[model samples]
Target: MTAGIDLGHPQAQAIQSDEDVVRVRQLVRTVAVAARLSLVDQTKLVTAASELARNTLVYGGGGVAEVTTVDNGRRRGIRIVFADDGPGIVDLDLALTDGYTTGGGLGLGLSGARRLVDEFDIVTGSGQGTRITVIKWSR
Candidate 1:
Protein backbone atom coordinates (compact mmCIF):
# COMPACT_ATOMS: atom_id res chain seq x y z
CA MET A 1 0.00 0.00 0.00
CA THR A 2 2.87 2.36 0.82
CA ALA A 3 6.55 2.37 -0.07
CA GLY A 4 9.21 5.05 -0.10
CA ILE A 5 12.73 5.82 -1.32
CA ASP A 6 15.15 8.51 -0.27
CA LEU A 7 16.94 10.23 -3.17
CA GLY A 8 20.02 12.28 -2.56
CA HIS A 9 22.18 14.64 -4.64
CA PRO A 10 25.62 16.05 -4.11
CA GLN A 11 24.05 19.46 -3.73
CA ALA A 12 20.55 20.81 -3.84
CA GLN A 13 21.51 23.22 -6.60
CA ALA A 14 22.92 20.33 -8.63
CA ILE A 15 19.35 19.15 -9.13
CA GLN A 16 18.95 21.61 -12.01
CA SER A 17 21.92 20.05 -13.80
CA ASP A 18 21.64 17.25 -16.32
CA GLU A 19 23.96 15.08 -14.28
CA ASP A 20 21.48 15.04 -11.45
CA VAL A 21 18.72 14.09 -13.82
CA VAL A 22 20.76 11.15 -15.04
CA ARG A 23 21.36 10.03 -11.51
CA VAL A 24 17.67 10.12 -10.72
CA ARG A 25 16.84 8.22 -13.88
CA GLN A 26 19.29 5.52 -12.91
CA LEU A 27 17.73 5.27 -9.50
CA VAL A 28 14.29 5.02 -11.03
CA ARG A 29 15.37 2.08 -13.19
CA THR A 30 16.90 0.30 -10.26
CA VAL A 31 13.80 0.81 -8.19
CA ALA A 32 11.57 -0.45 -10.99
CA VAL A 33 13.62 -3.59 -11.41
CA ALA A 34 13.68 -4.19 -7.72
CA ALA A 35 9.94 -3.77 -7.66
CA ARG A 36 9.73 -6.48 -10.35
CA LEU A 37 8.10 -4.12 -12.81
CA SER A 38 7.60 -5.59 -16.28
CA LEU A 39 9.59 -4.37 -19.30
CA VAL A 40 6.75 -2.34 -20.78
CA ASP A 41 5.80 -1.01 -17.39
CA GLN A 42 9.40 -0.21 -16.55
CA THR A 43 9.77 1.99 -19.58
CA LYS A 44 6.79 4.13 -18.65
CA LEU A 45 7.55 4.24 -14.94
CA VAL A 46 11.12 5.27 -15.58
CA THR A 47 10.10 8.06 -17.89
CA ALA A 48 7.50 9.36 -15.49
CA ALA A 49 9.88 9.15 -12.56
CA SER A 50 12.57 10.96 -14.52
CA GLU A 51 10.24 13.80 -15.37
CA LEU A 52 9.04 14.17 -11.78
CA ALA A 53 12.58 14.03 -10.44
CA ARG A 54 13.69 16.73 -12.84
CA ASN A 55 10.81 18.95 -11.78
CA THR A 56 11.57 18.49 -8.09
CA LEU A 57 15.12 19.60 -8.65
CA VAL A 58 14.18 22.44 -10.95
CA TYR A 59 11.17 23.88 -9.15
CA GLY A 60 11.00 22.30 -5.71
CA GLY A 61 14.54 23.35 -4.72
CA GLY A 62 15.41 19.72 -3.82
CA GLY A 63 13.83 16.65 -2.25
CA VAL A 64 13.32 12.90 -2.42
CA ALA A 65 11.24 10.48 -4.57
CA GLU A 66 9.21 7.53 -3.35
CA VAL A 67 7.74 4.57 -5.21
CA THR A 68 4.79 2.62 -3.87
CA THR A 69 3.62 -0.76 -5.01
CA VAL A 70 -0.10 -1.36 -5.19
CA ASP A 71 -1.65 -4.74 -5.84
CA ASN A 72 -5.34 -5.33 -6.26
CA GLY A 73 -5.90 -9.03 -6.90
CA ARG A 74 -5.77 -9.41 -10.66
CA ARG A 75 -3.82 -6.18 -11.17
CA ARG A 76 -0.53 -4.96 -9.78
CA GLY A 77 1.08 -1.56 -10.14
CA ILE A 78 3.53 0.95 -8.79
CA ARG A 79 3.05 4.54 -7.73
CA ILE A 80 5.78 7.17 -7.69
CA VAL A 81 5.60 10.15 -5.39
CA PHE A 82 7.98 13.09 -5.78
CA ALA A 83 7.96 15.52 -2.90
CA ASP A 84 9.85 18.77 -2.46
CA ASP A 85 9.63 21.79 -0.22
CA GLY A 86 10.45 24.54 -2.66
CA PRO A 87 8.72 27.40 -4.34
CA GLY A 88 5.49 25.87 -5.60
CA ILE A 89 3.81 26.45 -8.93
CA VAL A 90 1.58 29.48 -8.88
CA ASP A 91 -0.65 28.32 -11.69
CA LEU A 92 -1.48 24.61 -11.74
CA ASP A 93 -3.60 24.88 -14.90
CA LEU A 94 -0.94 26.72 -16.86
CA ALA A 95 1.73 24.35 -15.66
CA LEU A 96 -0.21 21.32 -16.88
CA THR A 97 -0.77 22.79 -20.34
CA ASP A 98 1.50 21.53 -23.12
CA GLY A 99 4.29 23.77 -24.44
CA TYR A 100 4.14 25.89 -21.28
CA THR A 101 7.32 26.38 -19.36
CA THR A 102 9.42 28.95 -17.63
CA GLY A 103 12.61 27.19 -18.61
CA GLY A 104 14.14 26.48 -21.98
CA GLY A 105 13.49 23.45 -24.15
CA LEU A 106 10.14 21.73 -24.80
CA GLY A 107 8.25 21.87 -21.54
CA LEU A 108 6.72 18.41 -21.34
CA GLY A 109 7.30 17.70 -17.69
CA LEU A 110 3.67 17.24 -16.69
CA SER A 111 1.93 16.20 -19.90
CA GLY A 112 4.66 13.89 -21.06
CA ALA A 113 4.88 12.38 -17.62
CA ARG A 114 1.15 11.82 -17.61
CA ARG A 115 1.30 9.96 -20.90
CA LEU A 116 3.94 7.60 -19.52
CA VAL A 117 1.99 6.53 -16.45
CA ASP A 118 -1.50 5.27 -15.67
CA GLU A 119 -2.34 7.89 -13.05
CA PHE A 120 -0.83 11.24 -12.07
CA ASP A 121 -1.49 13.59 -9.17
CA ILE A 122 0.14 16.90 -8.33
CA VAL A 123 -0.27 18.96 -5.17
CA THR A 124 1.48 22.27 -4.59
CA GLY A 125 0.97 25.70 -3.16
CA SER A 126 2.97 28.93 -3.08
CA GLY A 127 5.95 28.43 -0.75
CA GLN A 128 4.26 25.32 0.56
CA GLY A 129 5.77 22.44 -1.45
CA THR A 130 5.01 19.90 -4.18
CA ARG A 131 4.01 16.25 -4.28
CA ILE A 132 3.65 14.45 -7.63
CA THR A 133 2.55 10.86 -7.82
CA VAL A 134 2.48 8.72 -10.96
CA ILE A 135 1.33 5.14 -11.28
CA LYS A 136 1.96 2.42 -13.86
CA TRP A 137 0.16 -0.88 -13.99
CA SER A 138 1.48 -4.28 -15.03
CA ARG A 139 -0.20 -5.72 -18.08
Candidate 2:
Protein backbone atom coordinates (compact mmCIF):
# COMPACT_ATOMS: atom_id res chain seq x y z
CA MET A 1 0.00 0.00 0.00
CA THR A 2 1.11 3.55 -0.73
CA ALA A 3 1.62 5.87 2.18
CA GLY A 4 0.82 9.54 2.26
CA ILE A 5 1.76 12.12 4.86
CA ASP A 6 1.82 15.84 5.29
CA LEU A 7 4.98 17.86 5.05
CA GLY A 8 7.10 19.04 7.97
CA HIS A 9 7.81 15.66 9.37
CA PRO A 10 11.09 14.16 10.57
CA GLN A 11 12.04 10.50 10.26
CA ALA A 12 14.43 9.13 12.84
CA GLN A 13 15.38 5.80 14.34
CA ALA A 14 15.71 5.13 18.06
CA ILE A 15 18.33 2.38 18.30
CA GLN A 16 17.75 -0.91 20.08
CA SER A 17 18.35 -1.13 23.84
CA ASP A 18 19.81 -4.59 24.40
CA GLU A 19 23.65 -4.71 24.35
CA ASP A 20 23.95 -0.97 24.36
CA VAL A 21 27.69 -0.79 23.63
CA VAL A 22 27.61 -3.27 20.74
CA ARG A 23 24.49 -1.68 19.35
CA VAL A 24 26.07 1.75 19.40
CA ARG A 25 29.17 0.50 17.61
CA GLN A 26 27.09 -1.09 14.87
CA LEU A 27 25.01 2.03 14.42
CA VAL A 28 28.12 4.24 14.22
CA ARG A 29 29.63 1.95 11.62
CA THR A 30 26.49 2.02 9.53
CA VAL A 31 26.30 5.79 9.69
CA ALA A 32 29.93 6.09 8.72
CA VAL A 33 29.46 3.87 5.70
CA ALA A 34 26.30 5.62 4.56
CA ALA A 35 28.04 8.98 4.96
CA ARG A 36 30.97 7.67 2.85
CA LEU A 37 33.40 8.33 5.68
CA SER A 38 37.00 7.33 5.29
CA LEU A 39 38.63 4.51 7.22
CA VAL A 40 40.28 7.01 9.54
CA ASP A 41 37.01 8.79 10.11
CA GLN A 42 35.20 5.52 10.78
CA THR A 43 37.80 4.54 13.36
CA LYS A 44 37.46 7.89 15.10
CA LEU A 45 33.68 7.67 15.09
CA VAL A 46 33.72 4.19 16.57
CA THR A 47 36.21 5.24 19.24
CA ALA A 48 34.11 8.21 20.26
CA ALA A 49 30.97 6.10 20.26
CA SER A 50 32.58 3.58 22.59
CA GLU A 51 33.59 6.28 25.02
CA LEU A 52 30.13 7.84 25.16
CA ALA A 53 28.47 4.43 25.50
CA ARG A 54 30.74 3.59 28.41
CA ASN A 55 30.00 6.88 30.13
CA THR A 56 26.28 6.29 29.76
CA LEU A 57 26.50 2.84 31.30
CA VAL A 58 28.90 3.73 34.11
CA TYR A 59 27.79 7.24 35.04
CA GLY A 60 24.27 7.35 33.71
CA GLY A 61 23.47 3.81 34.97
CA GLY A 62 22.08 3.01 31.49
CA GLY A 63 21.45 4.90 28.27
CA VAL A 64 21.21 4.69 24.52
CA ALA A 65 23.16 6.35 21.76
CA GLU A 66 21.28 7.69 18.78
CA VAL A 67 23.01 7.80 15.40
CA THR A 68 22.04 10.08 12.58
CA THR A 69 23.53 11.15 9.28
CA VAL A 70 23.75 14.77 8.27
CA ASP A 71 24.37 15.97 4.74
CA ASN A 72 25.29 19.43 3.47
CA GLY A 73 26.22 19.79 -0.17
CA ARG A 74 29.59 18.17 -0.76
CA ARG A 75 30.07 17.60 2.93
CA ARG A 76 28.52 14.78 4.95
CA GLY A 77 28.77 13.86 8.60
CA ILE A 78 27.50 11.45 11.24
CA ARG A 79 26.11 12.57 14.59
CA ILE A 80 25.99 10.36 17.67
CA VAL A 81 23.93 11.41 20.68
CA PHE A 82 24.17 9.72 24.07
CA ALA A 83 21.38 10.31 26.55
CA ASP A 84 20.82 9.00 30.07
CA ASP A 85 18.36 9.50 32.89
CA GLY A 86 20.65 8.51 35.72
CA PRO A 87 22.67 10.80 38.00
CA GLY A 88 23.90 13.84 36.13
CA ILE A 89 27.16 15.68 36.12
CA VAL A 90 27.68 17.93 39.10
CA ASP A 91 30.38 20.05 37.46
CA LEU A 92 30.47 20.16 33.70
CA ASP A 93 33.42 22.51 33.46
CA LEU A 94 35.60 20.40 35.71
CA ALA A 95 34.50 17.17 34.08
CA LEU A 96 35.37 18.36 30.58
CA THR A 97 38.90 19.44 31.36
CA ASP A 98 41.58 16.77 30.91
CA GLY A 99 42.54 14.63 33.92
CA TYR A 100 39.20 14.90 35.71
CA THR A 101 37.54 11.65 36.70
CA THR A 102 34.63 10.68 38.93
CA GLY A 103 34.55 7.20 37.41
CA GLY A 104 37.84 5.42 36.59
CA GLY A 105 38.88 6.65 33.19
CA LEU A 106 42.04 8.72 32.72
CA GLY A 107 39.32 11.40 32.89
CA LEU A 108 39.88 11.36 29.17
CA GLY A 109 36.64 9.95 27.81
CA LEU A 110 34.99 13.33 27.34
CA SER A 111 38.16 15.07 26.22
CA GLY A 112 39.43 12.20 24.15
CA ALA A 113 36.07 11.74 22.50
CA ARG A 114 36.05 15.44 21.68
CA ARG A 115 39.49 15.20 20.14
CA LEU A 116 38.46 12.27 17.94
CA VAL A 117 35.43 14.00 16.50
CA ASP A 118 34.90 17.37 14.80
CA GLU A 119 32.13 18.81 16.97
CA PHE A 120 31.09 18.01 20.54
CA ASP A 121 28.22 19.14 22.74
CA ILE A 122 27.61 17.96 26.28
CA VAL A 123 24.55 18.98 28.31
CA THR A 124 24.46 17.73 31.87
CA GLY A 125 23.41 19.05 35.25
CA SER A 126 22.90 17.82 38.76
CA GLY A 127 19.53 15.97 39.01
CA GLN A 128 18.63 17.20 35.54
CA GLY A 129 20.23 14.63 33.19
CA THR A 130 22.92 14.22 30.51
CA ARG A 131 22.81 14.33 26.73
CA ILE A 132 26.06 14.40 24.79
CA THR A 133 26.25 14.71 21.03
CA VAL A 134 29.35 14.40 18.90
CA ILE A 135 29.83 14.75 15.14
CA LYS A 136 32.54 13.79 12.71
CA TRP A 137 32.55 14.82 9.06
CA SER A 138 34.11 13.14 6.08
CA ARG A 139 36.64 15.35 4.34
Give candidate 2's whole-model lDDT.
Answer: 0.77
Minimal lDDT window, size 10, model 1: 5-14
Q: Which model scores highest in lDDT?
A: 2
Estimate, for each residue in 1-139, the C-alpha lDDT of model 1 and write its tens digit. Answer: 2333333321121345667777777766776776678898898888877787888887787787765566656566676678888988899988988889887747898888888887778888888899887777667
Q: RMSD (Cα, Å) of candidate 2?
A: 6.4
In candidate 1, residue 1 scores what lDDT? 28
Range of the 10 consecutive residues with the lowest summed lDDT in candidate 2: 1-10
TM-score of each: 0.80, 0.84
* Best model number under TM-score: 2
The per-prediction tally of clashing pairs is: 0, 0
lDDT of 1 at 84: 86
Query: lDDT of model 1 at residue 119?
Result: 78
